[model samples]
Target: KEPKEQGDAKEQGNDDNSTEEPVTAISEDNVKDQSIPSPTPPTPPPQ
Candidate 1:
C-alpha cells in the first residue's frame, strides 16, 4: 500500500462563469434591438 501526502488537500475553486456573462449580454442586446421600433419602412414612395 502507498502512503498519501500530507499537503495534498488543496482548495479546488472551479467556477466556470467566463462565457455566461457575454452570452447574457448578447441576449439582452438582441432583445433590446427587437423591442425598439424602426422608423424607416421597407419601401418609400416619392411625393
Candidate 2:
C-alpha cells in the first residue's frame, strides 16, 4: 500500500512539472510581443 501511494504521488508531481514549462513559454512569448513598438499617435489638429 505504501509503495502504491508513493507511485501515485510521483506521477502527480511529474504531471505538474510537465505543465509548468509550456505555461512559462507562453508567458515569455506574450511579454516579447508586448515589447514591440506601436504606431505613433497622430498629431493633434490645430485648435
Highest TM-score against the true fold, candidate: 2
Alpha-carbon local distance difference test for all models: 0.53, 0.79
Candidate 1, residues 1-47: lDDT per residue as tens digits?
Answer: 12333233221211235466778999999887876644334234332
| TM per prediction | 0.42, 0.50
| Candidate 2 error regions (>4 Å) | 35-47
Name the top lDDT candidate: 2
lDDT tens per residue, model 2, 1-47: 99999999999999999899889999998877766433222333332
Report the number of backbone clashes for model 2: 0
